[model samples]
Target: MDNTVEQVNVLCIKWGDKYGSDYVNTLYSMVSRNLSRPFRFICLTDEAGGIRDEVEVKDIPKIGFKDFDEKHPWAKAHGWLKLTCFANPLYDLQGPTLFLDLDIVIVGSLDKFFEPEGDFLVIKEWDKSDATGNTSVFRFEAGAHEDALDYLKQDANKATADVRNEQEYITQFVDRQNKLKYWPEQWCRSFKRHCLRPFPFSFFQQPRIPEGAKVIIFHGKPHPDDALRGRSGKWYRKVLPTGWIAEYWR
Candidate 1:
């Protein structure tokens, strides 16, 4: 790996009460332990009460979209918060950044995500049939993709009318420019892939972390907490050592 950059910056977003501040605090420790380089861990959030003192906390930027202005029902869909990650390239931030979802638990080192060369980078969603990024983890220069926000603002509803989440809209927007790139295969894995023991096999099985995966994304239910409990509370008793998730919840 080239490792040419002076330092890498990490960013995560937290809004509303879904995820508690401990997720932010633990993530800071996890990332710090895994990446052995100079790095900044920034949390873009509305609440900063419980996060550890060592972590840098920043307010979630208002990306100037009307949807976010009025506090409407679909404010999140306006792509406002996700838009902040692109600000670095435009100089809103000082260096390269890897944006993460607060719900994720860092299981390994994130060094490889920084080494790849590209205008934009993200993890390939395992469920995607073609070139779709899961967006649970992604990296890019700030402000490099201002047009994505601009385009969404121009046709706010049209841009997000059908998509289910930010990853879909953002990846498609970046992909159109032919500049978006992805991390090496298997560097990012899905929690369902790496942590959960499937049904039928659930009675006796455990999640196998992929060999090269640096992060495992828990997109829907059966989050890290649920995985650690050895119980999704549904039909499958997907048991794994709860120790992994206990570390994150710390």
Candidate 2:
């Protein structure tokens, strides 16, 4: 490790009572094990009671649109709290920042994420043709994309009027300006789409990490722990024994 190297910020958010401290703690461990570059790990959350000591903790930043007249359910419905990372002058820390969802599993090197040159980089939506971002793992220079949140403050109704969630709104807005870029196709793989076998085959084959995939995203059902036990929430999509998750998801 270079003592004089600049420290990169790795950010995650946890709010409400859905995810316990274990989720955040595990994420930090995985990140530490995978990243070799100097980094400052931070978690912006409402309840930081159970997080480990090594990780820096901060309260979730307040957004500008708190009691808007329009029915903007980004907070209540979708995981909109993530947008706070784009807030200009975010918490005093500055430089390249990489944001990861608490539910993802890090199985490969993360140093390349911060190495790539781009205005804004995110996981391309697995199932979209119109340049939608998944936001599971995204990176941007601090204070570079304040416009994402500024639009919501200007007119929450008009900003999110047609979009269903925050990712769609943010991706569409930035993509239009040519600031949005996507990670290499194989870098970020979805557990449901890439790991789990097809419907019938899924019943017998265990979920495995795709070659060259650095991170596995558990977006909806069957979390990292769920995969360890070979439990696929649905009957159609089966998960057999997979030893890799047990070895990696510590």
Candidate 3:
């Protein structure tokens, strides 16, 4: 280990029981294998028990979503809590911070993510025609966009009404500042949209990993584990057991 080498931050937030510690541990393991450069794997969570010792665990930041909590208790489930990653002083972590959702599976080298020239980078929503970017895998300098969080804290009611989710809110704010950039289309792929075979073909064939995909975003339904076992999470859609997921998802 060279002390002089610069270490970037790899961050993930785990607030609820929806995902367990195994998800964090597996992500850390995947990152360790694929990222050549030195990095800090940090998990911001409400409960850190059972997480691997190698990961630095920090409590999830509180952005004071009192109004939202009262009116829309469902807001928390909508990823509003992720805005805390933009807090001005994110517990001493700084520079080129990559925020990854717990559900994502890294399959390629992540060194290229920090090489991109942009103040903020995200995955363009494949399903949307608008400028909205998926929040599954996004990068920004730590402490650079506290305003996004402030906007939500100041008026949770108005913020929630304006945007459908946290990703939309952050995307609009960064785009307004002319700092939003998207990764190449092939780098961060949506498993549901890009991998799963369409309709009838999906029933028999296993999902294929897209070429050049560094991170596979399991945004909804049939997460990495579910896909591995051939559980599509829906009756109509069929996902055959994919053995390759075990190759990289560990």
State the lDDT of candidate 1 residue by residue for 12-127, as single tens digits.
Answer: 88877778998888788788888888888888877899999888887776667766545456665523466655543432466678888777777777777778789878887777
Candidate numbers sorted by TM-score from highest down: 3, 2, 1
Prediction-by-prediction clash tally: 10, 0, 0
> Could you give candidate 3's per-residue lDDT for residues 142-249 as a string of tens digits?
999988777777776787687788899899889999999999999999888989999889878789999999999998798999999999898888889989999989
Please tell me which predicted candidate would have the highest TM-score against the true structure.
3
Per-prediction TM-score, please?
Answer: 0.88, 0.93, 0.94
Model 2 C-alpha lDDT versus the unseen true structure: 0.85
Q: In terms of lDDT, which candidate is stronger, 1 or 3?
A: 3
The order by descending lDDT is: 3, 2, 1
Report the lDDT of model 2 for residue 205: 71
C-alpha positional error of residue 60 in candidate 1 after TM-score superposition, expressed in Å = 1.0
Worst 10 residues of 1 by lDDT: 83-92
Which lDDT value does model 1 have at 131?
Answer: 66
Candidate 2 error regions (>4 Å): 1-4, 67-74
